[model samples]
Target chain A: MATVTILGKELAVDADGNLANLSDWNEDIAREMAAQDGIPNLTSQHWAILNYMRKVFEKEGSAPSIRRLTKESGVDTKTLYQLFPKGPAKRAAKIAGLPKPVGCI
Target chain B: MPSETEFQPIQKVSIVISKGSLDGVYPGLIMANGARMEGIEASLFFTFFGLDAILKKRMDNLKVATVGNPGMHMPTLLGALPGMSAFATKMMKKEIEKIDIPPVGEFLTMIHDSGAELYACRATVDMYHLKREDFTPELDGIISVGQFYEKAAGGQIIFT
Candidate 1:
């Protein structure tokens, strides 16, 4: 496992992979997650979503389908929308701390 | 210039276009469009009344909300009067169109063409009793909340 200090907090990086070199956006996300009491404090609901998203990416090398996310998390569609006001892909990618998906703006 | 390999790849992005006001719609569209230009895979999930922008009939008639939003900075209360939101929406739309950016309809099409997904909340659809036919053909599909999360799992999420 690798560890990095962001916004005065040390975050443990999973052995799956490491994020590319820190960028402004990366730092910003790290700060935002840190403000939420480090990623460890994230609710199981969020963790479940993020972890599954990562797994999907690792397996498919592509974005996962929304229908699949709903089935996997057992969270309602409306609740997921409420959780990610922008949309699921954007929010999940950010929280999962993966690079932006291909074909976005 | 940063070569493709030199630049970092975007893993995910989620954008929420929640405002029913016309002016509010542009920001979400702009951001979503911008993200697409950057080569990031993105999705625009319309919920609540925001679904108006995607509805074939109502999309062209969307209006801005000028009253009671603390987030909006208006030069004058009159600027946001009843009809002003609509006018403002038009002006904003014109400006964006002038830049060669596609109109809302076309922009949504581009997003879909680029492989970006669009979803309408099933609950909202049910609450409003909106029929699938009411939406434009571009809609990827209707989805439940849990399904939305499954897609949103691994990337950046934004609430516009």
Candidate 2:
């Protein structure tokens, strides 16, 4: 486990740097986490991906793979990488307070 | 007893795939895709028969080497029976799809879209007289072994 201070509140994160508690996540925290990751601004495109990941996680109990994200998130693979940067599925899931996706494709 | 500074994390990987069977090809594809998912640079060089993985006509129809593979757990003679390879391939494809892994064509697209470089070996392409149009559009280019070595520099090189 690890801790990150976001919005002046200390929060626990998992070993993979994902939020420990889904409820600990909010728009402010997502923005803070994104900023901490060097995405200084979260565009609506970014929110779309994050929101889609959260919705899928809520339903599926895990984050969607990159293929699913690209196919269903209304985001292409290139733009996903641009929005979340290297490892789009993993990073987007982290920012969305979802577990790391377990699928290989 | 090496110093910690000598143990830097793997930043890149160059994989050379020289076999064309479904079993032979998927390992390299999986490794390359896995590397990209880790934010590490990945490049795949398809040589010899492995070029089939990139060749549009053959990529989707790859079969498992049922006869020679000891892992098949059957007699080699029985493995040589016609339709055995097809049956095994069908079963494997089912298992692969059950796990949500895409077919070779779609998998290549996903890997390419994720920014990993895919290359077909120039020497083999020349030997086989394969034209550029014969390969998938996802291919970055046809490159020589020298070029492969150059790209592989400073990274771990894996042959599958």
Candidate 3:
């Protein structure tokens, strides 16, 4: 486990850096987390992916894999990588307050 | 002695896909895709029968190797029966689809779109009398084994 401080609050994170409590996630927290990870500007496109991830996690109890995101999230694989940088699936899940997706794609 | 805290993750990988069977080709693709998901640079080299994976005409029609595959739990004689390979391939395809794994063509496109470089072997291409137009447009190039090694230099090489 690890801890991150954002918005004057200390939040616990998993070993993979996702928020410990799903309820702790908010636009501010996500922005701060993204900034900490070197993405200082969060565009609407970024928000679109983040929201889509959260919606799927809410319904499916896990984050969508890269393939699913590409097929269903209105974002192509290349753009997803551009939005989230390296490891789009993992990084986007982290920002979206979800656990690391399982299995290799 | 110095402290041994210099552990590092793999920076890059070059995977060789050498078989054409559906089962044989997937391991390399899965690994290459996983490598890119980890921020590691990845490249794939297709040779011999593996060239079928990139060949536009045959990419989607790869079959499970029923013959001589002990893992199928069937006797070799039964495995050789007509249409056995096709049946096994259909079953495998269903299972793969159930798990959301795409068909070979789509999967290869996904991997390529995700930034992994793909290549076909020059020797195999010539041996099979294949042309550039025969391969998927996503292919980066067809190169010799020496060129493959040159591109794969300074990275882990995996033959699957």
* Leading candidate by DockQ: 3
Give model 1 RMSD, 1 decimal.
15.4
Instruction: Go through the candidates in order and give the C-alpha RMSD of each one to the true structure.
Output: 15.4, 2.0, 2.1
The residue-level lDDT of candidate 3 at B96 comes to 88
- Model 1, B81-159: lDDT tens per residue? 6677777677777875565555677667656654578988888989998999999999988898788888889888888
DockQ order, best first, reads 3, 2, 1
- Candidate 2 is graded, for docking, as medium
Off by over 4 Å in 2: B1-6
Best-fitting candidate, measured by TM-score?
3
Per-candidate Cα lDDT values, in order, are 0.66, 0.89, 0.90
Residues B1-160, candidate 3: write the lDDT tens digits: 7554566778899999999999999889989999988878999999999999999999999999888888899999999999999999999999988877889999999999889999999999999899999999999999999999999999999999
lDDT per residue (tens digit) for residues A10-71 in model 3: 99988777888999999998998899888999999899899998999899887877888877
Greater lDDT among 2 and 3 belongs to 3
lDDT of 3: 0.90
Candidate 1 DockQ, CA atoms: 0.05
CA deviation > 4 Å runs, candidate 3? B1-6
Q: Fraction of the real A/B interface contacts present in each candidate?
A: 0.08, 0.59, 0.67
* Interface RMSD (Cα, Å) for model 3: 1.0
Docking class of 3: medium
